[model samples]
Target: MKALLVKDNLPDFNGHAALYQMTPAHEGHEFVVASAANVPFSGPETYLFPADADGEIKSFAELDGSYRGGLSHAEALSNAGYTIG
Candidate 1:
């Protein structure tokens, strides 16, 4: 599923800042934000969360747990000192 990676004000499992994975709300699935980069988390069962396009759409695979909250995924990748695209 395509998801947006957004900065979460709260820290993650590792006690570090993290991002939120948000998707659209549907029948059984209320609009909620999940933990990005596979942090394994969801919401407190809310239905009033924003469902707009807040961040860049990325595949779940790209959120390979490499992000640890300092810089954004794209920014980190770009500043990795390598010529990666």
Candidate 2:
């Protein structure tokens, strides 16, 4: 499995006017503290991807454990027609 860390923030209204039309656009994705010492406003949050994730994944985990972010890399890979168990 792979993971991608996505920083959370308010959408930029000035640069992305079209995005504003899409209300609640920032509702997706989960965020977790990278470390115990890391504050909510500082440090990177871990975003776990499935083993079947496309392109590349930042974290790897067994299928038995709960996933942290979007679809697992493995699941994504399976959806893309790759056989991985």
Candidate 3:
């Protein structure tokens, strides 16, 4: 699954973004951001689809632990013609 992980550093007040490809492993999944430059900035960076994207934004609490937030990013990418796991 391909995802865009957005990070923000609050202390530095800088925001970084990156595209990642996630793969399911034996223990868990692996998250690899494509670019080092497009990384997050703050300690608690929120990951969600941009408003313009044709995807839904579900709250963390609403997920109920059934689905991982990273899956949403994969879904968005799949919808946009990217392959996902």
Candidate 4:
């Protein structure tokens, strides 16, 4: 599974129009979460796009259609302060 890995550059907690629309709504909205295990690296912040699908938990790549651009593994690993090979 993959996500649309990007920086948490959202403006405000209640200010970013796009994120605001992401709030929990009806049956269509689902809540899924992913976590890190101190393997590599990434982020001052990042968010799950589309907030997962109804009863769906996906990996970064799985977040495709729901998200746009993405970062490379090397970049992400480097960003998280890892020594990329």
Which of the numbered candidates is closest to the native, going by highest lDDT? 1
Error of 3 at 3 (Å): 7.4
| Model 1 lDDT per residue over 18-42, tens place | 3334233222222222322323363
Summarize candidate 4's per-residue lDDT along 1-85 as a digit string, tens digits.
Answer: 1222233323333212121112232123333222222223532332233344332333433221222133333333333332222
Which has the higher lDDT value, candidate number 1 or candidate number 3? 1
Would you list the rank order by TM-score, best first? 1, 3, 4, 2
TM-score of each: 0.21, 0.19, 0.21, 0.21
> For residues 1-85, what per-residue lDDT tens digits would candidate 3 score against the true structure?
3344433221221233233333322013233221112224523322422221222221222211122223243443444444543
How does model 3 fare in lDDT? 0.29
Point out the worst 10-residue segment of candidate 3 by lDDT. Answer: 58-67
lDDT string, candidate 2, 23-79, tens digits:
111123222112111224544222223211121322434222222333243333333
For model 4, name the residue pairs that clash.
Answer: 1-59, 1-60, 2-59, 2-60, 2-61, 2-62, 3-60, 3-61, 41-80, 42-80
Which one wins by TM-score: 2 or 4?
4
Instruction: Report how far residue 54 has shifted in candidate 2, in Å.
Output: 17
For each predicted model, how many residue pairs clash, with residues at least 3 apart or on different chains?
A: 0, 17, 9, 10
Error of 2 at 11 (Å): 28
Clashing pairs in 1: none
Candidate 2 achieves a global lDDT of 0.25
